[model samples]
Target: MSALAYSQLPNHLQPLLAKFYRAHNSRNRIRSEAICWVARRGDIVGGLCLTPVAQGHFLTGLLVTPPERNRGIGAQLVRNAVASSAGPVWLFCKPELVEFYSRLGFSVANCLPATLADRLTRYRSSKTLIALQNDQRMMPMPNATLNIAIACLLDDCGRILVVRKRGTRFFMLPGGKAELGETPLQTLRRELREELDLQLEDDDLDPLGHFQAQAANEPDHQVEADVFIARLPRAVTVQAELEEMAWLEAAPCERDDIAPLLRGHVMPALLARMAQAERVACCAATSDQGEIGSLAGKVSSIASSS
Candidate 1:
């Protein structure tokens, strides 16, 4: 796409494209040649850039605004890049980002002998590494089983143990569906073990509550979250399998930080329960006042102690 057509997008989107340009556009050479635009409502939400060094060789860069991510935009952008380019493309990413790039038909060719040039370039500027020789490897997505998962809430020292949601940016309780060889408790424990490397005892779990929470950022998927209260034997470090994990104060409904389901529905329900508790306390106080007046006359003569 040329400048005029690319400029048609909204101002916010234009900056995203500009950022890609600034990264790919540098002092030495013209590294990027192609750009793919992902738009909605006539506004550019995402874009991908490609720089070809030779025949059947190219490097790629993808940029997407936070709000428009996880809708397969990255994959779509990569598909466009592959189709437009001639042959074996390459991309460089951190070990953690391997999965993300893998989903877009990329594989690790070499992890050893960390390139000295690449390292120095990365140290000087991140874009230098991102612009390294085009990766020729392609990784196809393997068939993966789809299943429902749930999180059981357990509080420890004011910190909450949460299972990072797979394939999304959120954390909740740690639980999932039972596989063929697993029982309910086994499945729950297994998920925790796999996701957080933790073992659980039967006595440690107490049923706190259960509710239906729609999958965050997903429309059709719904989860029957069976929340529980428990204490961890000791603090355990979270493995990288889940996106991330953290404990948040159980408070007002909000999606700014936590999962959408928790922010949109679960927190609201909990807030209502807290309000109910306050109402119950007020009623108990009123009843105690009446009882005090009735007991006052009897107390005056019933028990006179020196």
Candidate 2:
């Protein structure tokens, strides 16, 4: 990725980038004052721009050309831009993209400068946006550490479905360790069917990346889990080794019954995603609107659930 002030960018490249931003209906949000970080891989792949904010810098104009997505171009651009800053870097993106940004070590913004928070409030009305700040923690764990596959099922009401095995004390995500010759995804599919009585196809799940934490049930060992996200389509009944199943609140809570991986990494990430949604919903709740009231109610119901 090449980082240069918009003014210092070569003359010919200026129009090209302007064309790019305009294509996304966001023009000179890359003005001469902003620093544009462009990345090319055998072709002009994509670019992201950063500008100064009082607390730190805010990232904007992250445009990855349509044809080049899933190739990690946008991720690379984001990584480079974030590393360039010595202070907190913030950005707002659609809710669906939370996992992608979370893998890059960004969680929801805990606090924000008045200007960006107001901008986000305005953006939240028309677009379901979530504000995130770089936590800068995207280091990969060894895959050989533990061959485990896990699934996170988030319901429409925004709660995560968790299960407690027949003899287990902790409530954890529904999944299990991999068997020999099975890939993590395959392990996940089989485990889900066995424990939750829920059968899912490969397309039903989206990879959230891998995580490592001390095993909750297995002592003296750690688990390297390949985490995936899926929508909870229907009600699940406990089966096979599962003794009970329940919905876990997405909001942060001080519960001691959570498994290690769920407590350490996954919960924190989910909480970050919830942070923006809470503000969006609660902001509307404090005012008076039924639509927003529904969301606020959901949040309230979740926090109060047994």
Candidate 3:
């Protein structure tokens, strides 16, 4: 596949691009200054348009033919647009597609540029536009920080419960930011109740360790975590504040969305504790067997002597 500049595209491919944009119901007119990137696999397989908006560029009309979907053509098109653009890139997509864009390194913004915001509002009202099915907005890309408490709730099967917040792709521990006057443990308990609907007392939680890592949602910001190990019940009804939940093994996970602190610090600590507990249990069992053997020999000798 190759990325072609708009002027580089053959005249024969121009019609195909127009058809692709129409199919997606894109209203953004291709202006003289706008940058369009087309992905071709002998024919036009996918494409994206970046139009200048305020201080950044708005990514629009991104589409991959159904036959070419999941083949990485869409991702390549996005990469091309981002690589060619000199400013921050922004886009409005359905709430469901937030994770998709997030994996491509686009952070969701709590605020948006005025022009893009107006366009998004209008796009939502248009029934012809399928991509803007939800009212979720995208913001200009910037770095920010998040303060939160995290928990490593391990089940009997040695799986840790990880949670992904709404509108986010990465899955971290089931905890939130520390509220004023609330200790880390208190934050953990409150978050558990609010996020997982699981209640716990101080006795149920054990301090694993304090950790720090990059925040998943905010770029260039760090997350300071007070990590703890909580014993989860056999079954849990996760609250709706989370997008999804998973019971992942305490090992090197291949998932990209796993939080940095959980992957680097929390999991390893939990694994070490589990190993230590196993060793202690094995030693205790061996000692008990040795005691039993010694008592058996003494009883046998006493019987023989009598």
Candidate 4:
């Protein structure tokens, strides 16, 4: 369908599309063959389109009129669009519409290299990209705040200690935001002591890294989490502020289990620290061995002097 014909849809339906997709601009948007189809039921009851831009491929304006929805037209339109796109296809959807796209073989993946989250931060209060699904839209709000925590540290033993966020069913790390007059380090220590009942000195706090995550457990909130690594004490006890805790392996808390910002920025830094630690150990061991050999030579020299 030509972009002109799609643009000619009834006036009322235009706002519906625009509401779900902020990118829907009737005057400015000209249709490209690169875009998928613009389906109309006699009077243009529904439409779907694909827009390819420099950042990545985005599916937009998948709309079905309120009266004609749930008759399988929307799914058919989306399926056609997905088949045409080559690279990673992404669309924004609200918390409610996650299942609808999932059933259509669209699992919620991180909007990577530049997602709605990144755009919110970059564009400064404008939603750079809005994902659409059914009646819901995952629109970006600039510099949105989120609640977050570092769940666990995957040690050499492959054990991960997942902490339950205080007073939430969703499990996360035992940490909280910085209070008045508290640095990130101070906030972490206070939170750890409050939730896990462990005392940690400054040296014990290994800066793990920070990550971007959606607070799906809460409405209209997101988080940029700063994770840290600490030596967990044996037989650690917990306090009431912590709801629950568990120790799972690395597989469950893989990058997917954490927030997106952490996956890209925070995890890389943590991995680099791990590498640095290994290098330091190797250097220390070599130095010790050299010292032992030098001591024996010194004793042999003293005997020759005698």
Tell me, by TM-score, which candidate is best. 3
Worst 10 residues of 4 by lDDT: 132-141
State the local distance difference test value for candidate 4. Answer: 0.57
Cα lDDT for residue 300, candidate 4 = 97
RMSD for each of the candidates: 17.6, 14.8, 19.4, 18.3
Q: Model 2 over residues 92-133: C-alpha lDDT tens digits?
A: 988898987886768888898899989999988887899998
lDDT of 1 by residue, 219-285 (tens): 5565545444456677777674676677766566454656655666556655565588689999999
Deviation of model 4 at 281, angstroms: 1.2
Model 2 spans with C-alpha error above 4 angstroms: 1-145, 274-306
Quick one: RMSD of model 1? 17.6
Any runs in candidate 4 off by more than 4 Å, and if so which? 1-140, 147-160, 166-170, 201-203, 237-241, 248-268, 297-306
lDDT of 2 at 208: 62
What candidate 3 gets wrong by more than 4 Å, as runs, is: 1-145
TM-scores for all candidates: the values are 0.38, 0.45, 0.52, 0.42
TM-score order, best first, reads 3, 2, 4, 1
Scored by lDDT, the top model is 2
Error of 4 at 296 (Å): 3.0
